[model samples]
Target: MNHKAWSIHFIYAGVILLLAGGQMYAVESYQLTPSATKFLAHNVGPGPETAQGAINHFMVNSNTGVRETITPPGWVAWAALSAGAVLSVHGGMLIANKR
Candidate 1:
C-alpha cells in the first residue's frame, strides 16, 4: 500500500467515525417535537412496530403523571443506526482495500 492510499483510507475512516459519533449523539439528545409527533402519526401508518406506534408508545410510556424525558422515535433512531453502520462499514472497507 502506498503512503497516499493509506492516508486516504485513514482520512475516510476518521470522517466516517466522526459522522457516526455525531449522528448517535444527536439521536440520543433529540426529543420528539410536537410537529414531529404529528408528522409521524400522519405518515408512519399502522402496526405496533410502526413509527407512529413507537412514538405513541414512547409518549404514553414515558409520561404517566410525572415529567419524564422524551426520546426520539424508534424509526428515527433505527435509521440513524443503520446509516451509521453502513458508513462505518464503507470506511472499514476503504481501509481494508488500501494496498
Candidate 2:
C-alpha cells in the first residue's frame, strides 16, 4: 500500500485499539450500589438491569458497602465511537490528499 494508505490504516487501527481499551476499562471499573440498582430497576428499562446488577454486585464486594458513584458504560462507548469517527475522517482526508 502507499504511504497515505498505510497512514490511514494505522490511524484506524489506533482508534480501534483505543476504543477496545476504553471498553475494557469501563467493564472492569463498573460499580453500582444496591440503591442505585433498585432505582434503575424501578425507573430504567429492563435492559439496564443487568448492568445495575453488576454494579450492585461490585458494591457488595467492597468493604465500604456504600453506594458511592458509578460510571455508565454508555459514556465510554460513546467516547470510543466518537474517537473512531474522528479517526475515520482523518484517514479519509489523508487518502483524499494522496490522490
- Candidate 1's C-alpha runs over 4 A off are 1-69
Clashing pairs in 2: 32-55
Clashes of 1: 1
For residues 9-54, write the lDDT of model 2, one tens digit per residue: 9587757867775675557455677667556545555343588666
Among the numbered candidates, top TM-score falls to 2
Writing each residue's lDDT as its tens digit, candidate 1 over 1-99 gives 665566566566656665755676566555565655555554655645877677665664453432334565556555655565665566567666764
Worst 10 residues of 1 by lDDT: 60-69
Residue pairs clashing in model 1 are 1-99
Best by lDDT: 2
* Root-mean-square deviation of every model: 9.2, 10.3
The local lDDT score (0 to 100) that residue 22 gets in candidate 2 is 65
lDDT of 2 at 58: 50
